[model samples]
Target chain A: MNKSYLYLFVRFVVLIALQVLIIDHINLGGYINPPLYILFILLLPFETPGWFLLLSAFALGFSIDIFSNSVGLHTASCVFMAYMRPTIIRAVGAPADYEAYLNPGIPDMGTQWFVFYTLFLTLLHQLAFGILESFYFAEAGIIFIRMIASSLFTLVLIVLIEYLFMSRKK
Target chain B: MRHILAFIWKHNFFFLFLVLEILSVVLLVNKSYYQRAVITNLTDRFTGSINSTYSSITGYFYLKQENDKLAAENAVLWQSLKHGLVTTDTLTTQLVDTLNRQTYRYTVAKVVSNSTGKRNNYIMLNKGKRHGIEHDMAVISPNGIVGTVVSVSDNFSWVMSVLNKHSKVSARIDRLGQMGTVLWQGQNPDKGSLTDIPVHVKVIKGDTIYTSGFSHIFPEGVMVGTVETIKVKEGDHFYDIGFKWSADLNGLSHVYIVKNLFREEQVELSKQVIDE
Candidate 1:
């Protein structure tokens, strides 16, 4: 198998396992169910093409939806994050001119840039997921509360995982 | 049109995201009919397994609390049993006089999983289809009514917790006997509202509320809550009644599943009336 395909497959399996086995059980009070599986989207190769990102994000979220029974909430949120990833990367400036094969790593992108990148992506993903999950104008306040709680939790997990695992890989 | 298509081709990701978001919104809005039932069942099973694992892990920490609760409950049960036996002779005469009155039976089960913060929260019980737990059975904690069963598997069932936005129970005031519909406001799990009680009915704060038994799901006199506030809406004839739920749902570990023996017959009879 191609190295990229092999890498992507491993990443998919690891993320799904982590989400279902570990993160799903960490309720942490206040209805904060973090979707750490979005790390798969975050770690996609920088040059993986926009359509592929959109499709993969959709598939990742749809699979989670199938597992969590939340219908299309996760799928919608993941696609939104994938769509905004490029813009967010550009806004944060190219991570050293965006090398095609460069995986998103703290060492490659610097701690500060990676933090901002993960924060924005995690926030976007949580906001979309929370809003879609609530799906009621009357629930705007509760949705906001859930969004903030879930985003904060997801951000902490993303940063810890990046620092511990991806930082070591580099 | 060609230029638009070209622009769309250039911004395919953005278009795809928009389409997916729209599709999701449509699905959410049409939850009544287009809900993915199969997916829900699969997720329920997956969650059930995951929760069981976590329950085993956390069950260790909760052993002391569970033991204490059980001990306290056992004391109460013993006292009640003794009192009932002592009053048996007198109660026999009263029971014969009220032979036509309704009676309720309670079956106990532990709450395997519970959630309070979600817009549509649910609780899972250790008992299910094999345990005579059918759809629409009312679940009550030691404090008050929790919710009704929404789905059931062979060994487990999910209850739509009273904290959910969709929860509605028929309730009546204990003192005044004024009736209203109790609904979750989705703001606080400890509090809910009783709407449609006529303003003319005399009601006071702290009035006890119980199930009206109008619904096939719950039996009469199951504790619901107490009136915390009775605000007469300006220019409206109905009072906006606030209630403090009698059941401490967040702290609930064990609950009773109430099965109405006459539910099937009552439902069939009602359906016949509607058909006629």
Candidate 2:
């Protein structure tokens, strides 16, 4: 259990760092803003306590929000994503989804299941974030375009990160 | 009471989710406009250090390009100097009339972090309150207006970039003398729209825009941008004028924070005008 906590801590720092230091700096055509830090919540163990899941998700998002000078945008989206994670898992998840499976990566969940999982959560998070960030600022038509672009951009990066870790496990 | 306790236990997850989500939204709503979150102030100190460390390492990469830009700026300054006129033999008693006409003091700052791709973008500078940076001071790049300082800490200040949706600058068409408001209409960072110009006003393409000094936050005649597109819909009184921003927010590494000495006095005087 302690080892698992350490792993979570390391992943937390690594993901947040990668987000603020690298990902936040990339503004592809002003449409694709991939807040790739959501991967932290996505990779959490199924057994992670609900309260822990929400708090950690909040912390993860709050960190990004702080780094980017946005106060609560990431926090709101992350909490939403975390709250919906279990429901999403059950919706598209296999009957075999279990703690013994050692966290949900592409290897254990398979590419198809992982893609659906990442896509749904990423799109939802991006949509929520895009709306909140552009609530009174952006055009309605542009918000949809930004959400879709950002979702796809994040999806590609999440899959690549999972693959990199999956190969490392080998 | 027993049944209520059991129900609460059973729905604890949903309750926790609600509480957490509501708290997040509270933070969001409270900090939505101009209010700064107390939590963010703490976080800024932490992120500020980390960012400064990161920028210190990365700043080396931009040294060459930065040097070239500085050299070019220096050349422009040199051309305007009267050094070629030569000082005619020393020690003549000249009328010493020293008058302070400069109302703006500029403090140089290095951009440690910036974002342009997001709908609401912000920039972080290495200097802060200790460095004489204050809230609502106008920030400019070497080329043109960049943003305004929003939040300042002990050693860092957060700048709301012009690319931000909330950013609206009082603007004027230079040659035409027509007045409008320059704002980022979302999407492109390099472009912004100048609105409020009446349809009757003839706005030619490529006309330059400048700060109108209507708002004391920015000085008058600061370079804004050059007009790119002008469209006037039928029956609409105003023209939809799009202009290319002179400063590139995406590539900014250095900026100047302009502090107006008479800002408070100007504001005080203007406040009385409304009453009359």
Candidate 3:
């Protein structure tokens, strides 16, 4: 448990830093702006306490918000995605009795479940973030386009990261 | 109480979800730019549209007052334009001063009531004897002649609209200089006929027709209408002319009633000549 906590803490700092310093500045022609810090929530162990999950999600979102100069948008979307994680896991019929030390990742969950989990959470996060950022019905079309493009971009990056770095379960 | 506590404990995650959602909302609303944009978008979609629709409805109610102010301003412009040049140049001072008489005065009046569907269509104006509007004064809109005042009360006057069967005005072809009388045929509000234009004159389909100033009611060169068609039957000495109406009489809201300053003097002189 202690080792996993430490791992989560380290992952949090690395992802937040990467998101703020590099990804935030990248402009793919002002479209497909990937937000990868959401991987932090997706990687959290299924056994995490609900309140702790919510708090950590808020903290991660707030940190990204501070860096991006978008005050509450990232924080709100992150917390919302975190709140929705269990429902998504249940809907996807993940094993009810998850290992205490195990996390939702490419190595443990296989390629299909991991992709589905990551893409679902990323889509939800991007939706909340985009809708909050552009608060107008007239902008719904452009917002939908941005959300889809950014979600796909973020999903690809997260799957690539997990495949390249995570140890395969034997 | 224990059941309630158990229920609360059982649904603790949902409560946490609700609480966290509330907190995020508060942050979103209280934060700068992004949150404001969200709130603005939500309210703009819902309340903003309602407010705009409401204002648009109320805006229609204000059009009458706005039109009244516009008509009054137009009256001043028309008065100055018809009164001739008030010269300040030293060389033309003596010559221009003699010419600059206030031969015409104008009063802005709202069309309180109007009709085009009626054969003897009459327009009721908001101004009457109290506002210096008298019977026989000519009425015109910004576009063209509307009618002549036929009767007046203390605060209201009735006008003979150009669509009325009794209405007649001396008009001429602007390019041809051929004088004709414009009279309504008691049908077709959009059209009128120019009578007494002889067949020998070259009347084209698009020639402009204007007031001939012979009636002493309307000013010279005021737009009447454009000649729409010209027909000359065999053995007929006069051309049958149909002209399209220049002013939208059915939708008239603002009009100027012309008060000719020299009208009474002209009438008296003409009457004396008739009596002799």
The model with the greatest DockQ is 2
Which candidate number would show the highest lDDT if scored against the true structure? 2
**What DockQ results for candidate 3?**
0.10
DockQ, in order, for the candidates? 0.37, 0.80, 0.10
lDDT string for model 1 (B82-189, tens) is 465565487786776778644555779877677665556678787877788877899987668999987777677778888776788998998888778989866666
TM-score of each: 0.80, 0.94, 0.45
What is the DockQ score, from 0 to 1, of model 2? Answer: 0.80
Q: Where does candidate 2 chain B have its weakest 10-residue lDDT segment?
A: B91-100
Ranking by lDDT: 2, 1, 3
User: Which residue pairs collide, candidate 2?
Assistant: none
| Model 1 chain B poorest 10 in a row by lDDT | B33-42
TM-score of chain A, model number 1: 0.92
Best-to-worst ranking by DockQ: 2, 1, 3
Off by over 4 Å in 2: A97-99, B32-37, B82-100
What TM-score would chain B of candidate 2 score versus the native chain B?
0.91
Write one digit per residue (lDDT tens) for candidate 3, span A1-170: 68878988999999987875457435364445688888888888878889898989988887765433344677888889988999999887777666675678877777899888888888898888877765667767767877888888888999999888886544
